[model samples]
Target: MHLLVCGGTGCRASASDSITESLKERLQEHNLQDEVQVVMTGCFGFCEKGPIVKVLPDNTFYTEVSPEDTREIVEEHLVKGRQVDRLLYQAPEGGRVKDSKHMDFYKKQIRIALRNCGFIDPESIDEYIARDGYFALGTALNEMEPRQVIDQIKESGLRGRGGGGFPAGLKWEFASKNEADQKYVVCNADEGDPGAFMDRSILEGDPHAVLEAMAICGYATGADKGLIYIRAEYPLAIKRLKIAIEQAREYGMLGESIFDSPFNFDIQLRYGAGAFVCGEETALIHSMEGERGEPTFKPPFPAESGYLGKPTNVNNVETYANVPVIINKGADWFSQIGTEKSTGTKVFALAGKVNNVGLIEVPMGTTLREVIFEIGGGIKGGKKFKAVQTGGPSGGCLTEEHLDTPIDFDNLLAVGSMMGSGGMIVLDEDDCMVSVAKFFLEFTVEESCGKCAPCRVGNKRMYELLERITQGKAEKKDLQRLNNMCHVIADTSLCGLGQTAPSPVLSTMKNFWNEYVAHVEDQRCPAGSCKDLMRYEIIPENCVGCTACARKCPVGAITGERKQVHEIDQDKCIKCGACLEACKFDAVTIK
Candidate 1:
């Protein structure tokens, strides 16, 4: 018997740390600690009801467990044989209480990429071993040939998950086919996309999963050393990774003579200093070698010449997570999961206006409707779904019209969006499309490595255009200029950073053109988002005033006598929303 508590970032924020500590203490007190091993695992997804707690053997999933309830869990379940009925997830539609397996969110997901994410304690090598960790490396070394392993991956139809969607096996073949004395295998764990935690979560939850997969990759590609280029901001992930590597070395998994095999493969960590542009392969390689994180033109490609000018193969965390599963299950079993072009599953950090926001891994061809409605539990506040911004800042927004579009590499590309590292941010009608575009552009401008002139200057200028539009300083010519810059940046930029920087602006302009037009032509923000176009006005009819608004205004913009209607000084108003909160009668209205 085992108890798994969600220790992922989201659950951590919700006080799962206390729950874990309390559960451990309570179990020890009850003296059932020997019978049921309590494990602090990573996210169980289903984040809406987090922090999640799962008991194995019976597989009883308890959602929203507070620290105080840890005693109840230990006493009732450990002492008695009765299952706690009230703690189980109450289905959104109020049906019978079911376990995690019966839930709709997990029903559609075939978790090839996230197989070990929620199930095992990342810090423990034994838990990882229970789930068949290091088995793939052992199998590869003992039974199979290196070329045969590569060929199996080639037949699996797996593509890269790091936005580019290149063929994974083909990329490996490129590195393997290249004859070099010193070769490299880099796990591109520097996941910099906003609202994307799939890579980070995998590293935090299942660091050994990546470690084993990278070893498999090293043996397949004829490489002996592996490097995980992870962002420095992921402190927990780095800690877990270090622990896993040390354990593997102690157990003869990472260092020389792994399971007494002739093949030698080991891994090291290179910390990336939070550069969004460094997510690019070449730039990541450059940063790893203590150079500036900037992308170079890809002619030689990472496979031919990467880290220290060696034959290299770089795949993101999600891509590598699938390698072990693909090898163990065979290419045919893996290929049957998704569409013809995109094989296996994709993990997405489903965030924004969605209710059940969490880490989800769905089959490749599943429609956005299913992801949004079935898995996500629909939009929050019952607001109408406006658009979904896929692929982070680089990828475009998809409107209601594109909801049914199957989520695959080529299909997403066909509609001006790419399945970028799977950061699916849902938006509702209240979210201004113009603001959304500007916000992404702002992020891109800040994160740009500024390697080339077009990306450096063009993206900043494009962001300026968006700023002007939102500020009502934009003209008709500005729209034409925005369109022109989009093409220029896309065509002339050095790498994917510059090339896809214009996606948000272009996507919004194409899908939400009317909103952009209103901002420019009418000089008004239709969605009431732009503060420059809005003023806090007192509703005299609803106001008892009572000097509350005047006293509460931080800027002293409001002036009023006792129990009199307040008048806001237009020049003094900063639109900080202080007066709106202070007014008891809902008198303050933004116009």
Candidate 2:
């Protein structure tokens, strides 16, 4: 019997480490330590149901278990051969979530991009090997030629999952087609998208998956050296990747002739200084070469002239993770999974106002309804779903009108949203659309590499217009100016960083124009999110003047004597939301 404990970053925050240790202690106490393997595994995509403890052989899935439950789990399940049904995942309808394979959330997910994520103990090389981790590399070395490997990927129709949707095989063919003494394979782990951790989690949960895939790429493109351009903020992913690389080197899987083949390749980690624009291929190459992180015009794309003017191929973490799967199972098998254009499943960290918040890997053509409802379990608190934003800060918002649309590269673009690194942020009716647009604009303004005036100045100007509108200081004419500027920025920007900056504004305006109009025409934020246009008030009947709201007010804005009605001083209230959070009387409100 095996017990897999979640060791992903999100679960780690919720004290999953304590749970793992406690489970071990319980196993030892019950004398089941040797019989049962308490394995620390990568993220189980059902993060909302973690810290998860999944018992294998039976696949008895347990969710939201505390350290205390560890004792009961060990005693009852391990000792008595009975399952802890209560600890099992709860379905959306409130009954127990199924333990059987058919009923699991993973049943609905086609995990091509996330094949090894939840299955393997990321830190251990043996566990990765047990699950056929390096089999593809072995097969590639002994059985297939370099050209054949590239052909399999080409036949798979696999495109880069990193927003651009460029064909993976085409990119590899470009590099392979050229002959160079010193070529390089790069993994773009510089995930700077707002609410996007698809790549980050893959690196954290299955670092070896990428490492192995990079080795495969090295063999395919005849590159001896590889580099991973990961952000410095992802210390956990970096640490795991470092361990995986060292382990691969030791095992003769990564360094020197792997599987005794005539190939020697190794990967080095490159730390990105947290620049959002550096996710671009050219900018990533520049950073790797010890230069400033900024993108140059493509055409002499990274496949041809890249990384010290050598032939280089770059694929984001998600793209590389798919390599082993394609090689082992065959590209024809992968091509059958998703739609014709977008083959295989995609891993997404479903976040924001969704009911079930976690990582999800669904087929490419799955409708937004299935993602937001069937898998996500719908919006939280029964709030109406206003929109779902895919593709991070650069991607635009999709409203209920577009919810039925199938999710793929072309389909998303047709609706004004691009696949920007798989950050799907669900917004509710309570969330002000104008504010949402402004927030993304702010991120772009801050993260812009300042390579061109369009992104540097134009984005800041657009943000200023959004700020003015939100603060009730601008006319409707300002909206026109922002829209006009968006077009120019999209057209004039050098790289994708500047070109896609206007997406949030354009998408929000297209879908939620009413909210923007209401804010501008009536000088009222319907969502009550704009602090400048809102005033907090305490209703006399609702307030018992219990001094609760007053005491909770951090700004000393609430004033009343004992049991009398209290009033909020508008000037003093900074709208930190402390009073609202503390209020049990339902007295505090924003206009």
Candidate 3:
């Protein structure tokens, strides 16, 4: 029997480490420590119910397992051989789900890249090996030639899981064609999207998978060295990656003559300063080479010259995570899983407004409706679904009409969005589209490398236009100017950061034009999200005149005698909504 406790960063923040120790101590008290092994594994993807604990053999899964509950879990479930009904995941339809396999969240998920994540103790290389961890690398080194490996990847149709969705094999072939004496394989772990954590989770949970994949990539592209360009913000992931690399080297899985073959490959780590622009390939290479993290023109692509001017193939962490699986399962088998064009599953960080906010992986061609509704458990608090922002700040906001749209590189792009590192942020009806656009623009503006005038100047101008709209100070002509400027920036920007910086504005304007019109023409925020456009009024009938709101008003915006109706002084009203919170009668309402 085994007890698997979630050791992912999210769960750790919730004191899952204490829960692990408590469980072990309880097992020792019962003299069952040897009988039942306690293991701390990576993320389970179902972050909503973490910190989770799963019992092996019986397949009993527990949700929100606190350290205090560890006693009952060990007593009833471990020792008594009975399940803890209260701790089991409650199904939306009523019954308790015994295990993850039966849960709706995992029903649609196909965990290929996340295969070992929630299953093994990430710190243990032996546990990783037991699960066929380095089998793919061994196979690649022993059986397959360099060109054959590349061809298999091509046949699998595995596109890069990074924003670009470029063909992985084609990139390898490009790097291979270059006659550089020194070549490199770089894993882009600098995931800077607003809600994206796919790359970080993979590294934390399955670092070996990425290391093995990079070695495979090194062989395929004739690259002798690999570098992981990860952000310093990810301490846990960096720690696990360092451990995995050292273990791989110690075990002869990495270093010279791996599997007794002629291939000599090793991996090193490069720390990023969490610059969003560094997510781009050239910018990442530049950062790795001790230069300012700014993007340059791409005539000399990373494949031709990168990382101190060598042939370098750059693929993100999730992209590399899929490599070993493709090698283990035949290319044809992997290719047949998804749509004809995009053949493989994609990992997504499903965040915001959604009830089941967590990491999810689904086959390509899965509808947004299925992911948002079924897998995500619908919008929180039963609020009406408004939109979903895919591909981070750079990707566009998709609406209800696009719910049934198949999710793939081509399909998302066709609907004015991109599969950008798989950050899916769901929005509700209460969310203001205008504000959403402004928020993304603000992020883009702050993160801009300032390499080009279009991104530096144009995005600031666009942000100011949005600010005016939200403040009810913009005319209808400003809308036209904003629209035209979006095109100008997108067309003129030198790099992808500037090019896609206008996506949020363009998408919100396209999908929620009425919201923009309300903000502009009516001088009102439809969602009541913009503070400047909101007016708090007292409902005369609802106000009991107890002076609760008046006492709470910081700026003295309310005035009335006791036991009488109150009125707000609009001139003094700061729109702080303090009265709304202080009122017991619910008299204050935003208009």
The model with the greatest lDDT is 3
TM-score attained by model 2: 0.81
Candidate 3 lDDT score at position 530:
92
Tens-place lDDT per residue, model 3, 553-584, is 99998999999999999989999889999999
Q: How badly does each model clash, as a count of residue pairs? A: 0, 0, 0
True-structure RMSD, every candidate: 7.9, 7.9, 8.1
Q: Rank the candidates by TM-score, best first.
A: 3, 1, 2
Q: For each candidate in the order shown, give its overall lDDT on alpha carbons.
A: 0.89, 0.88, 0.92
TM-score of 1: 0.83
Residue 313 lDDT in candidate 3: 94
lDDT of 1 at 455: 87
State which candidate, 2 or 3, has the greater TM-score.
3
Off by over 4 Å in 2: 1-106, 538-553, 556-567, 576-589
Q: What are the per-residue Cα lDDT tens digits for candidate 2 across 54-84? A: 8888888888888989888888889998888
Give the TM-score comparing model 3 with the true structure, all chains together: 0.83
**lDDT tens digits by residue: candidate 1, 1-591:** 899998765577789988988988998898877888878885554666788899897878898899998888888876886767788888878764657778766767778778888889999999999998878888888999988899999999999999999999999999998989999999998898899999999998889989998998888888999999988899999999999999999998988877888878899999988999888999999999999988888888988999999999999999999998888889999999999999889999999998779998999999999898767766776578999999998899999999999999999989988899999999998888889998998999999887799889999998888889998999999999999999999999999988999998898899999999998999888888898877889988998858887887888888878877779999999999989898788888888
TM-score of each: 0.83, 0.81, 0.83
